[model samples]
Target: MAVDMKTIEHLCSLSKLSYDEEGMEKVMGEMGSIIDLMDEIKSFDLAYDDTKDGNEIRFADTREDVPEESFPTEKLLANAENTDGCYVVPKVVE
Candidate 1:
């Protein structure tokens, strides 16, 4: 698959991005390479054993979840300059 100027322009517009001629050419080349890689990946024959449960096979090495003690709320909020029940921060935007 080839990435043409029209496709690049459309993608740029959709992403709210702008590029110069040189930048566009570079992007087009990179996008073509990515498409070629995807095509190559699609041609691979990926197989999995159906006899075993897929989730059990995939997660066999993972550790079990365990609960632990948490920090006191007062200690967590102690350093705040302005807090009501939580840490206070300055309003960022209008």
Candidate 2:
């Protein structure tokens, strides 16, 4: 599979990346090497068993659902610099 300039440009655009001609060429080369490695791996066949029936996978017991507790309004409001009933941070956007 040939890695063309258009394909590289499209990939960069999707990633919101800015690259000059040299950077683009370098990225294209790296991508080409990766694709080549994948192609090589595709030609190999391994008959490895992935069965997990007998193996015990230990995991922590999940937390049980409990009644939710609400914090006091006065306590919560005290933490806010500018509060009607909630915490307020600096305005980030217009």
Candidate 3:
């Protein structure tokens, strides 16, 4: 991972982050090491088994969904603008 200032600057702009020169140097070093670690992880070997139905294997481990008691409607609506049991938002779609 050959990191350069140009790449870091571009990444910073995309992430809406700003840093001074010294801070930029520190961030670049940390990001370079992270990228190097990710590159190293690419070398790991793992086995994959496609003979089983993954959905059924996972379904047996899931807990059953059960309905539970809820808070009073008045308590939930106390701090927000609401109408007819729902919060009102400004319409953004035509």
Candidate 4:
């Protein structure tokens, strides 16, 4: 799979980002390397036990769900800019 300039441009357009010529080249190189790494990974045959009564085995170390005590609402919201039992922050955009 090739990582081409068209793909990079499309990604940047969707992300609302711009890059200078030099920066674009650098980003292109990094993206190409990441694609190559992904291709290499795709070609590997990972080892996994597939013979468990003809079904794949699952993890058995999961613990039971148990709720625990947590900090009070007042203490939890202490560092917030403003709160009245609900967190609030300065709006940065319209």
**TM per candidate:** 0.44, 0.45, 0.46, 0.45
C-alpha RMSD of each candidate structure in angstroms: 6.7, 6.9, 6.1, 5.5
What stretches of model 2 exceed 4 Å from their correct place?
A: 45-60, 65-94
lDDT of each: 0.88, 0.81, 0.85, 0.84
Residue-wise lDDT of candidate 2 within 2-89, one digit each (tens)? Answer: 5888998998889999789899888888898888778987767976576845565555565657978898888978967898666778
Q: How far is candidate 1 from the true structure (C-alpha RMSD, Å)?
A: 6.7
lDDT of 4 by residue, 1-94 (tens): 5678899999999999989999999999999998888887776787666564565445575666799888998998998888978998777996
lDDT of 3 by residue, 1-94 (tens): 8689999999999999989999999999999999998898778786667766455557767778888889988788888865657777777987
**Model 4 lDDT on a 0 to 1 scale:** 0.84
Worst lDDT run of 10 residues, candidate 4, spans 50-59
Write the number of the candidate with greater TM-score, choosing between 1 and 4.
Answer: 4
- Give per-residue CA lDDT, model 1, range 1-94, as digits (tens): 8999999999999999989999999999999999888898776797666766555555757777888889998898998898899888988997
Stretches of candidate 3 exceeding 4 Å from the true structure: 44-94
On the 0 to 100 scale, the lDDT of residue 90 in model 4 is 77
lDDT of 2: 0.81
Please list all clashing residue pairs in model 4, or write none if there are none. none
Clashing pairs in 1: none
